[model samples]
Target: METVEDVTRMHLVGGNLALDFVNTRTGPPVGPSDDDVLTGYPELVAWGAYAGVLTTSEAAALRRLSRDDPDGADATLSRALRTRDHLDEIFRPLAAGGAPSTSALARLRDDEADALGHAQLEGGSTYAWVWRADRTLARPLRPVVHAAVQLLTAGALDRVKGCGGCRFLFVDESKNRSRRWCSMDDCGTAEKMRRYVAARRVRARR
Candidate 1:
């Protein structure tokens, strides 16, 4: 298992916020995941800050609030974890060229609506949805929720893929859509080394 001390190592290679959010934990190509980095509310907020989902002040404020209201922090943590799992259920299947359950889609829609309820539109040339400024514990997660909506509505589901090396989710944004690893410096290099050793063994046996 990867020794993920904190969200600083989430890798942030998903190329999209929703995908990055779902990858807070990792699994195998055909099994369950045991590596979870976001162990609690503070870690969740740290991840949001690391992923650029939360501003520095927002992150600091959330941490301060967590100290004052531990129960509320725990509740927000539960919500964040649930949201992450909810996203995994929706995106994992889609990454493997399968459709997510209808119920999952419905739940995602409802979640988006709930997030948008706290949003206010503002702009000069073109307006866009922006979260209402507040110190609520759930603020860190609102951007993630909106990102899920954006990824779903963007109409490029085909680009989403599960990495051939580590089963991490990412979008194949290459011009030819041929990206196969979450990181060439990590998974890609490891895979190549494995193949190289295997090839050497085969030649030695001959």
Candidate 2:
């Protein structure tokens, strides 16, 4: 039973807005960090890769977007959203069998194949650039977007959001509506420790 808030904080497949949408922390320990996003893209791309086919250019573009930047990060972020939205819309109808035409699917498949070919050529014979998106060490977009789409059509894109506490994107699989950190083993534990110390001080004062 994932709430909107929980879902918002756990997934980020598309854009920076996706990360902002999931910001739920109220203290110094809240909000996704730039580092979180820098690391998270690999996971999200991996998830997209598992969901369907990703062209070498698209994967390369994603890697380029992830490079360290300040003023230009916004443009990179915009490109990411554009690419993601394109994929999401393309798949939206595919998963629905909308209009009963294989034309759309065939075209997309062909385009992906062509792009992949060019990407491999430009990236060199080894296709090593394709794997650049995988080196960030962030949690990969698990089970991929296509798999998620296969489960349901036309769901809110915001469900795929970044961490409220960090840029790490994850699927909110909480059962108690209590997930508010990037990782329970990290932010969550730190939060509990702070609260415990605060409580102890209050008792000592009394």
Candidate 3:
């Protein structure tokens, strides 16, 4: 059985948000939060190109190394980070206005479906099967596709776009449609308070 540490390490290596979805815990010895997992997804969701081809032994070794040594885990994470940069190039256009239609996205979808059929019939490699199961020829790209599709089809780019804290992406589905901060509990409140204090200071100076 894979321990929580083992799975977390694998997720860092795999560099996929889906691994976070499958994860059973969070941090500070916390159990998983479906909300936090969805919101605070650390995986860039763009790493399929590099993480898709590991042999089972390689995957297992990463898990083992992650469990045993910080150095090994850091090395694997560094590789994942480099791959994430590559994925950024591939996914940047999707978020920007050039994303294809759902049908076109569906084609990427269908290709993997077809591959899964072939894998089922042939049963060559479990890793290959896992790769195909993601419904993307590129495994970590789906979230970008999901967000892009939601944006384009709903035409919510201007309203839904922008992460206040950083370059992180998210769909702002606030009912008021005035959501300024990326998160109310975190950045929203803090930024608001900071602005308030700054305004007060300016008044005092005046």
Candidate 4:
């Protein structure tokens, strides 16, 4: 379990809002542990603010509302986790040049369908979705579902890559399109050290 400090220290390295949302959990690439950063409703709001999904004031407001209605907050947290799981199932296969499961796609479509009603055209050409300012804990998921749809429709699925160390998804927006790790300072460095040690052990055996 990550401490509050660890959660607050999370960075936005996923390059896309949806991918950043998917990266709340951290661990090994295979059989990753459930080390979720958003352990509670407040943490979820904080991460939303950190990921630019919500304004700081919006996060604060949501925090207060969660305190006022703990059951609603719990429901919201469950919905957010379900969204994350669906995204992981959908995007991981797409990133690997495979198709997403029908169930996952269906869930996403349902979420998008619900979210579409809350949107409004802003400044003639721009569109924006409005979340309820009151007890609707599921409001934050609107933008996430919107972002996932945008990424899928944009036909940039080839740019999506999974980290070699932690299996977190990220967009490989490099010039050469060769990004292989979540971060150079974190997974990249650790992978290099691992390879170096393996090579030294091989030499010792020789």
Candidate that scores best on lDDT: 1
Q: What are the C-alpha RMSDs, in order, of all predicted structures? A: 1.9, 12.8, 11.9, 2.2
Model 2: lowest-lDDT 10 consecutive positions: 136-145
In model 3, which runs have C-alpha deviations exceeding 4 angstroms?
Answer: 1-62, 65-79, 90-160
lDDT for each residue of candidate 3 in 1-206, tens digit (9 for 90 to 100): 33333333433211223222222223321222222222111222212222344344444444454457656445544544433333333233343445434544555344345434434332545421333333322333333333233334555544433335433333446687665544566556777899999999999999
What is the per-residue lDDT of model 4 for residues 1-206, given as tens digits with 9 covering 90 to 100?
Answer: 65556666986788787788888887777785558897888788877776777777777778888899999899889989999999989988877879899999999999898877766545557755555442356667788888898898884889998888886889999999999999999899999999999999999999
lDDT of 1 by residue, 44-141 (tens): 88888898877888888989999999999999988888888888888889998898888888878888888888778889999988775767888878
Give the distance in Å from residue 12's predicted Cα in candidate 4 to where it truly belongs: 1.9
Taking all chains together, each candidate's TM-score versus the true structure is: 0.94, 0.33, 0.38, 0.89
The positional error of residue 196 in candidate 2, measured at the CA in angstroms, is 1.7
Rank by lDDT, descending? 1, 4, 2, 3
Could you tell me which residue pairs clash in candidate 1?
none
- Error (Å) of candidate 4 at residue 113 is 1.6
* Candidate 1: stretches off by over 4 Å: 1-5
lDDT (CA) for every model shown? Answer: 0.84, 0.39, 0.39, 0.82
> Best-fitting candidate, measured by TM-score?
1
